[model samples]
Target chain A: MRWFWFDRFTEFESGSHATSVKNVSLAEEQVHDHFPGAGTMPNSLILEGLAQTSGMLVAEYYDFQERVILAKVPRLRFHLRAVPGDTLIYRAKIDSIEESGARVSVTSHRGEELQAEAEIIFAHLDRHAEQRQLFEPNDFAKLLRTFGVFEVGRKPDGSRIRMPAHLAEAEARYRSQAQA
Target chain B: MPTQDEIFHKVQSALVDALGVDEDEVKPEATLVGDLGAESIDFLDIVFRLEKSFDIKIPRGELFPEDILTNADYVVDGKINDAGLEQLKKRMPFADLTGFEKNPAVQDFATMLTVQDMCNYVASKVDGKA
Candidate 1:
């Protein structure tokens, strides 16, 4: 099976982070089978959304090597039911990357409303069943160019932080939200 | 030589057939969940299709406590460990063999999927560390 939920990547960085989007619709049949009458997007899929976003980020780091899958999900939570007509924006950042594995944090949003969040860890191995290895950085620069980079964190004063150049506009957006 | 483009095209063909959508609609730009309307179960089916089509194993995992993010944060990181492979080696009830060829899930909103969902499922079944 594959992670088919992440539309395509809107932005990506091999070693740092990535971003993608998903547009949910009422026409989705899973909604009907899940609740019958109400038919809400399942929490598992929501998590899948996060995993896929982060998985690709990890894959880009590997230059789409063998393949990246969820080895384990240490934590997950669903704050609300995502119904049709909601466009979910997924963002993921690398917390750390090592030869054996990597860890990442993912967040989802619907027009500024905090929808979901998760932390993911991934390991890379060959399809031939060899031990895990460090993914290739062959496409790192090209991939990074495709998806711009951003800075995330908070200032000492408890204000949010942003990148100086790449994400200047995004930084302003987040800061504005912080003030609001 | 097996180029990435070949593999990508194969993946795309499986998606087009399994989802019953137009091949043009199956571009890399398409989002499985958002654009395709795929859900978890449907995603499982897509995995089965890809495995049969590509003859590969896909790593699979579920949510635990430490990986929770907000709803919009759909980023997960993990390699399909030994445990995950064992689970997938077992029967996959989520997949349906009957309507696979015609893309029973296509345009049905009942069955489209994002690319990542399909990839992870395939990753779960892969025998990466054997």
Candidate 2:
């Protein structure tokens, strides 16, 4: 089963930074299992939300040619616990980007109060070197679209960030298969 | 060759376009990261725009020195040594380092660089001095 940590991206700038939001809800199984009655979101899950926001930013820098994997959390601090009714807003800013890897500063907020802040590093893996596929292309494309990457993303000049031809083709194939 | 005014306008436009900031916000004295709200990722976008606008190739780490922190001779115990600071000032002449001299941490130098510094660097590169 595939897990998406973030609900949708509210802001996306190619090769730069992104902002996403996740709503903590009673419907989430983790909330029910966490305390049975308290209904507090897990701190680890909040970290995942940070990773997803920053990971996509790093991946977009490479034009999605390489697979970006979370390498480490060099620093992390939690100031508050998020409850079921809270809405978590995640903002990730790139610290440095190199050919092999990148670093990002991530912060999660619940209505202006800081919940957690983390510094994350990501390693770029060459797609060809890894024979095994981590994600099916069509599924990944669908995930990107659902995240609002294509809709809200823009270049430095305020122009729309276009989906690469390969991903577009994959999405087309996926749509046709669904229709068939 | 473009005039100084022309170069300034181009550099300012590039920064505005790259960082998604207003034209007035990208002043010569504004620090790119602190004042103009440029993230590390935005540096690449700014460089790309500069290259296309001016028809010049900016090698990695040339516009912004990336290797200074990793070099043992320049850094010690997370702080940039005096010699290293001098070397950095030499490389990035346009940057305002008056405050950085008091206590120089390797990590903090990038944030100290201002938009005017970048514009000057671009001018130098175009003039064949870089």
Candidate 3:
């Protein structure tokens, strides 16, 4: 099974904010049997969607170089549960970013109504975990490409965001290694 | 510059939000980790909130000097030596090191910060006394 919670990015602006959508469907086993009878999207999964939305945004700030992890959700308030068939639109905006980590304020909306609002803190593994590889650079870049980040992503000046060459080079290296 | 009460209030709010503790629980002498149940990750969250609330730039290792504690020159057998204690004192005058000076065990360092100490730090930063 995949850990993808959100479907795709509709708006992705570099160093600022991004919006992603998750369609709750009863076809998903968890939603169908979340309460045995009620077909509702689990709150935890909703939080995952929110996290992914913000995590991707934070990772892009460094061209996906830093090992960014969800450190804490300082604030998360849910107003209502999103049932299957309801689309949860997650909006994540970077509050601050520094060498230590970053803070993002996010909101999940069902159409025009707000479902949840959260303040998420992501910590970069810059200190002790510097020597460890949190993820394969190629897989990471491919995931970002699959998520349509480059398609909708824009720089601060409204230019299209480009994929980092290092990540692409890492992928090319991996492909050559496999072919060899 | 913000007054003492103003700084305290802001610090209190930041701790409350970051630690998910009650406003009444953030006493002047309450230790952040021991009294408020803050974890290592919470410190990062608290720092960001404090920075935002006070509109101040809190450089890493300023509020908490984990580096000094981890440094080999300062730590020996899980205890902070005299040099380490002195470095901590010089960097963190906002914190009262009298209690921590007795043992200077690196393990017990997390319990050193209090609500009032945080307020003092913010005050010093705002008044340019730090």
List TM-score per model, in order.
0.42, 0.58, 0.94
Q: What would the per-residue lDDT of candidate 2 be over residues A45-164, giving only the tens digit for each residue?
A: 899889989998888887777788887665789999889889999999886677767778899999989999987868777566667655788888888888999899888789987787
Q: Against the true structure, what is model 3's DockQ?
A: 0.78
Complex DockQ per candidate? 0.02, 0.03, 0.78
> Any runs in candidate 3 off by more than 4 Å, and if so which?
A127-130, A177-180
How does model 2 score by TM-score?
0.58
- Candidate 3 chain A minimal-lDDT segment of 10 residues: A126-135
Provide chain B's TM-score, model 2. Answer: 0.90
Instruction: Give the candidate order by descending lDDT.
Output: 3, 2, 1
Candidate 1: stretches off by over 4 Å: A1-3, A126-180, B1-130
**lDDT winner, 1 or 3:** 3
lDDT per residue for candidate 1 within A3-93, as digits (tens), equals 3575656665556776787878777777668888886877788888788778756664544554566765544666677888888888898
The CA-based lDDT of model 1 is what? 0.55
Local distance difference test, per candidate?
Answer: 0.55, 0.83, 0.91
- lDDT accuracy of residue A145 in candidate 1: 34
Task: Give the better candidate number (2 or 3) by DockQ.
Answer: 3
Best by lDDT: 3
